[model samples]
Target: MNSFFSQPTLQLAQSLIGMELVHESKEGITSGIIVETEAYMGPEDRAAHSYGGRRTKRTEVMFDQPGSIYMYFIYGMHVCFNIVSGPPGKPEAVLIRALEPVSGIALMEKRRYSSWKRSPAQARKIMHLTSGPGKLCQAMGLGLELYGSKMNKGPVFLKENKKIPASMIEAGPRINVHYAGEAAEYPWRFWLRGSPYVSKS
Candidate 1:
C-alpha cells in the first residue's frame, strides 16, 4: 500500500488521474475513475497543511508512511480526502479533486442531494454529484474516520486501471489557494482533459 504512493507528490498526482477509487460499505460499493488531483509539496509548499514543518494531531498521519490517508475538515464543514505521498517525514499529499462515477451512482445521489425537496435536472445532477473534492467526499462517504488509514486495506481502496494518455492530461495552478503566495501559482494541479467530472475547467 505504501509502495503505491512512493513517488514524488507531483508524479503521484498525475499518475492517479486514471485510477479507480472504490468505497465499499453496507449501503453499497460506490466506485469512480479518478479524473482530477492537486499536489501539495510538503513543508516548502505554503498551500500544504504541513507547511513550515508544523506537526499536530491532525497532521501526524501526513508524516507517516506513504499511502496514508490525510482527511481534514474545512470552513467548519466538508471533509476533503488526501493521499499521503513522498517519503516519510516529508508530509507531501495529493488531494483528490474529482471523480467520474463508475458504479453505485444512485447511492451517491442519495448521499449527496437527497435532502432537496425537488429533484434537480438529470444532466445537472450528474455533473454536480462528484465534481469537487468536498462533493466527491460527501458522495462517496469519505470522512475523518478514514483518516490515517492505509490505502490498500478495508473500506476505501484505489484499484489499478488503464493509464490515461499524456495527450489527455492537463496541468495548471491549483484552485482556491491564493494565500499560498507564489506557491499558489505553481502548476501543481493535474486532470484529464475533456472530462466533465473535473472540478473546474
Candidate 2:
C-alpha cells in the first residue's frame, strides 16, 4: 500500500472515497470497501473540537502528526475512529463512516453474530454490522487501545481499491452533528452511492 493517507485532511477525505480499510487482528485480516467518510477541518471549523485552537486532553491527540488515530467513546458506548490529518498543531481528521465487506466476511459474520446473537437476522445484514461509526469500529476491533496508532503502518490501515468508481462517490451532511450548530450543516460526509455498505444514505 502506498500510504494513500499521505494527503492533507480535505484531500484525504476526498481521496478516501474508494479506498479499502484493512485490519489484521487476532481474529484475522478483515477488509472492507470504504463507502462513507466525513472530514473535520482543523481549528476554525466549529464541528471539530480542535476548532478555535482549543486544546484539551481529548483534543490534544487531534493536533498530533497526521495519519494517527483519534478514537473516542460516545453515549457511554461506541468507539469512533478518526484519521488525524493536517500539520502539527492543526487538528484535522477524516471520520470513516461505512464500509462494504470485501475480505473476511466469514470472520465479520462470526464477530457480529456473537455480538448480536439475539437478533441473528440482523447479523446477516452486512450493513448493520458496519454502517455506523461505532458499528464499524466494533466490527473492525478498533478501540481506545488503538488510540495514537499509525494508520500508514499499523495492523489497520487504508489502501487503494480501484474497483470503486469516481461516479459512485457522493458527498453529504455528517450524521448526528446537530450539536455543532451551523457546522452540523457542513456537507463533509462522503459515500459511495447506492452501495449496500453505505448507512441509510
Give all TM-scores, in the order shown: 0.94, 0.90
lDDT of 1 at 119: 53
RMSD per candidate (Å) reads: 1.7, 2.1
lDDT of 2 by residue, 128-175 (tens): 878878888888877788888888677988777686556777877888
Scanning candidate 2 in windows of ten residues, the lowest lDDT window is 115-124
Q: Candidate 1: lDDT of 198?
A: 91
What lDDT tens digits, residue by residue, belong to model 1 across residues 1-201? 566699878889998999999999789999999999999987899999999998999889989998999999998879999999988889899999999999899999889877656755544568788999999999999989999998878799988899898888999999999999999999999999989889964
**Candidate 2 lDDT (Cα, 0 to 1):** 0.81
Q: After TM-score superposition, what is the CA distance of residue 37 in candidate 2 from its true location, in Å?
A: 0.3
Q: Score each candidate by Cα lDDT.
A: 0.91, 0.81
* Model 1 residue 15 lDDT score: 89
Q: Best by TM-score, which number?
A: 1
Error of 1 at 133 (Å): 0.3
